[model samples]
Target: MTTAVFAGVDVEVNEEGFLVNSDEWTADVAEAIAADSGVGPLTELHWKVITFCREDAAREGTAPGLRRISKLSGVGMKDLYALFPKGPGKLAAMVSGLPKPQSCI
Candidate 1:
C-alpha cells in the first residue's frame, strides 16, 4: 500500500493508484484524483459519471462497469472516453475513489 495526497488529504492507494479504502473518499478527493488521472477538471457531465459510479459503488460494493456507466449513467461511450480518457471504466473508478474493477483489464 502507498499513500497519496489527494486534495491535501492523505489516503491509502494500491499499486495502480486506486484507493485502498473507499470510505476515505470525498468529492474534493475525487476532483483531485480526476485531475491526476488526466481529466483536468470535473464538469457537470463528469460529475454525472462520478456521482453515478460512487452511488453504484456504495450500493453494489463496486463501481459500475463501462457499459453500465454508458447505459445507466447516460454518458455514452465516446463521451466517457472524452471525459475520462484512456479506459473509462478504470479511470472513472479511480476518479470515484474506488478500487479498479476486475473488468477494466
Candidate 2:
C-alpha cells in the first residue's frame, strides 16, 4: 500500500485506492480518486453519491448498496457504473480516504 498525507491525515491506499479517508474525505481527495480511477473531474453528482455513501457507511457500519446510493444521489445504476467501472465503489470511496465504511471487510 502507498500513503499520502492530506490535511494532516495519513492516508494509506492500494493501487486502486480512492476511498482511503472516507471519514474525512475532502474535495482534493475526491479529485485524487477521480484521477486514479482514470476519470475526469468528479461532478457534483458524483461527490453527492460518494458523500452519502461515506456518511451512511459511517453511521450504519456497512457500505450502502447501489439502490441506496442511487436513492441518495439520484443517480442511476448505469451512471454509477459508468463513474465507477470497478466492482466496489465503496472500496474506491474508502481509498479516497473518505472514511471506514460500515460493511467494509
Candidate 3:
C-alpha cells in the first residue's frame, strides 16, 4: 500500500479499496497514484484507466469492475488483464491512491 496528498487532501489506500479524491484529480495526482500503486512506470493509458477507476469508485462508492474499467477507459478486458494479471485491478487502482471502498469500511 502507498499514500499521497492530492489537491491538499490526504489519500490513503492499499490493495483492497476504492479510489477516492477530495476534489477532481489531475495528471499530477495520477502520477502520484502510479507511484503509490507500485507501478511507477505506468504509461499514459495506465494512468487513464487508473484515474477513471478512481473517479468512478469515488462517485459510486464501489470499486468499478474490470468490465466497467474497460468501458470507461476504452481498454479491452484482455488488455487490462495483461496489465493486472493477478485479478485485482480494482485493488491496484486503489493502491494508486483511490479511496477506501464502502465494503472495506
Q: Work out the TM-score per prediction.
A: 0.92, 0.64, 0.54
Stretches of candidate 3 exceeding 4 Å from the true structure: 1-40, 99-105
Q: Which stretches of candidate 1 lie over 4 Å from their true place?
A: none
Checking candidate 1 for backbone clashes, the offending pairs are none
Q: Write the per-residue lDDT of candidate 3 for residues 1-105, one digit (tens) a residue.
A: 555464465665334433444343556665665555555656766766777776786788776666667767787877776665544454445544555434421
What lDDT score goes with residue 22 in model 1? 91
For every candidate, C-alpha RMSD to the true structure in Å: 1.4, 4.0, 5.1
The candidate that wins on lDDT is 1
How well does candidate 1 match the true structure in TM-score terms? Answer: 0.92
Q: Against the true structure, candidate 1 has what lDDT? A: 0.87
Instruction: Report, for every candidate in turn, its global Cα lDDT versus the true structure.
Output: 0.87, 0.61, 0.58
The residue pairs in collision within model 3 are: 19-98, 19-99, 20-98, 20-99
User: Which prediction has more favorable TM-score, 2 or 3?
Assistant: 2
Q: What is the alpha-carbon RMSD of candidate 1 to the true structure?
A: 1.4
Q: What is the lDDT for 35 in model 2?
A: 65
Model 3 gets an lDDT of: 0.58
